[model samples]
Every structure is written in structure tokens, then in C-alpha cells.
Target: MNLAARVITELFQPTVTVALLLLFSPAVEPGFPGTAWFGAVAVLFVCVLPLAAVVLLVRLGKVTDHHVSDRRQRAPVLAMAAVSLLAGLCLLLAIDAPRSVIAMMLATVGGVAVLAVISLFWKISGHAGSIAFATAVAVLTLGAPWSPVLLLIPAVCWSRVVLRAHTVAQVVAGAVVGGGVTTLLWWLLLELTVRRA
Candidate 1:
């Protein structure tokens, strides 16, 4: 049970989830010029670089674990990730990435910022939040066909709890913040893009 929970947590960690989402963006909006490059840039800054920071910090003993389960150690990590995210966003804009990809990145930035702020005093389940955000975005972009992804939210939340990483309230809050904020932001961005087009 413990191993299964850990496996799920690691598999759907934020960096992995974000990487998959970006890599899959091309499929969502086909034929956009430089679509593959957009995903590569996003994965580099938002996923690769941030993940490197965490691994380095863990090696340096600044972070107790790769997951950064210690809330006290999360700020610097989140800050580093935010820098990477902002850099990615800027580069994506400069390169004229597709509107759908840009919208997804923007929503990602917002979600990370919110989670960073919330992690200050509370140990939120980042696992739950990340999976929920990914699921929400999948549903929003892929429509009813992808609605089934919603099941991932509770599954991830349960994994977090089973591992004793977070309380029920913390996981629930993570899901709400992750799903709600990203959903609203992604939806609004897509709507605005449509309106302008």
C-alpha cells in the first residue's frame, strides 16, 4: 500500500504532469507553427529546470526530499520554479507560441503562484493540486471526452492521504485551488483569445 501510494505520488508529481501537458499540447492544437518547439521550451523551463533545482537542493540537504514534503523548505524551491515559469512564459510569448499553448502556460503560472503563496504556512498536498490542475485543463481543452480524467483528482488525493503526507482538508484545499484556479484562468484565456480572433 505504501509503495503504491508513493508510486502514484511520484508519477503524477507537478513537474511530470506539467511536462506531459505541454508535450501533449501539439496534439490538442495541431498545425500550429513551431508547436513542438513550444512544448520543448515549456518543458525545459517549467519542468526540467525546476526539477533540477529540487534535485540539487535535495543533494545539498536544503530540501529533505525530492517531493519537498517539508513546507519549510518549499519557498526557495517554489521561488526557483516561479523564475523558471516566468522565463518560460516570456520566451513562449517572444516565439509566438500557439494561443492554446500560451493559455495553458499562463494558467500554469497562475496556479504555481497561488500554490507557492499557500505553501508558506500550510503543508498542502502538491500531488493533489498538480493532478487536479492537469485533469481540469484536460477536461477544459478536450471537452466531455476527457471529462473522465476527473477521476484522477480523488485518486491522487487518496494517495497523498494514504501516504500520510497531508490531511484531508489540506488535500481538498489543494484540489480546489489547483482545479478551480487553473480551470477559471485557462477558460478565461481561451475565451479571450476566441473573442479577439
Candidate 2:
């Protein structure tokens, strides 16, 4: 594939997406919520899950003589994501921690969930859906973290498009999937946790 295609694929890939999300989150939202220990957990969930998926796919491909790209096994991928989200939530709730810590944990869970969904869509559609979903969130959320996240979204989308790993449509679709899901989760958490208190 060309450079653009490689960039696109890298951007859309779960590992890359999660890493970028994690990086951006800390960068935009300063101060380590609580113990800073939770950050390690977040990094593990973001990085390990995708790496595991890639390993599984590679092994399965070799053993079964089938082309097992991340897209082909949506169930496992989503399951991993759900597991990570649950883990993050449990950690946050169990800590008897500060509100900031809890909020940060909730945000991480929401973000990872969004990344998983986007990966699934990228496997199927391409980039267009991702971009559309992201754009909608950017417009609706305005000054929220979701909107700021849009900054990274375009770079990721463009990388995928340039690499030709995904068609413009697929890249957009992935953005939509990522942005919409994350925004919804974040909003729900805010309402349930922050507003209720």
C-alpha cells in the first residue's frame, strides 16, 4: 500500500487510536486526577487489548489459513472493549476516591469504548462514517472535550485517507463511530455521576 494507505490503516487501527486518545486526554486535561496509579491501568487497557487482538488475529490467520483481520472478528473485539470498560469502572468506583479521579476513570472507559466501536466500523465501512460521526459530535458538543478531540480526529482520518488503507467514506465512518459513542458515554456518565451529586 501507499504511504497514505499505511497512515490511514495505522490511524484507524485500535492500538493506534487508543494510544492517541490516551495521549490527547492527558494533554488536554491536565493534572493526574488522583493516585496517578490509575493512569497505568488506563494505559494497560488502551494498549494491551489492541495488541492482544492483533496477536489473536495473526495466530488465527496462521493456524486456520483464513484472513483474520481485526474487522472480521467484531464480537471478540467488542468483548475486549467491554471488559476493559467494566474494569475501569470497577476501579474507579472501588477507590473511594476524589471526584476528579472518578470522572477521569469514567472518561477513559467511555473513550476506549468509542475506540473499539470505531475499529469495528473501520473494519467494515471505511473512513467516511467515522468522519461524519465525529463531525456531528464536534458540532453538537462545541467546547466539550469531544470537540477538542476533533483536532486529533482529522489527523487520524487524513492519515488513513492518505495511506489509502481506507476509502474516504470508511475513514469518515470510523470517525463517526468513535466520536458519537464516546460523546454519548461521556454525557451519560456526567449526568449519572456528576449531576446526581
Error of 2 at 56 (Å): 4.7
- Candidate 2's residue-wise lDDT over 97-191, tens digit each? 44434554565456545555656545533233334343443454355545655565666666666654456776665556555565566556546
Q: For each candidate, C-alpha RMSD in Å?
A: 1.7, 5.6
Which candidate number would show the highest TM-score if scored against the true structure?
A: 1
List per-prediction Cα lDDT, in the order shown. 0.83, 0.52
In order of appearance, the predictions have TM-scores of: 0.93, 0.59
> For this target, which candidate reaches the highest lDDT against the unseen true structure?
1
Q: Which stretches of candidate 1 lie above 4 Å from their native place?
A: 30-34
Candidate 1 global TM-score: 0.93
Query: How displaced is residue 148 in candidate 2, in Å?
Result: 8.2
Worst 10 residues of 2 by lDDT: 62-71
List candidate 2 segments past 4 Å from native: 4-34, 59-70, 97-151, 195-197
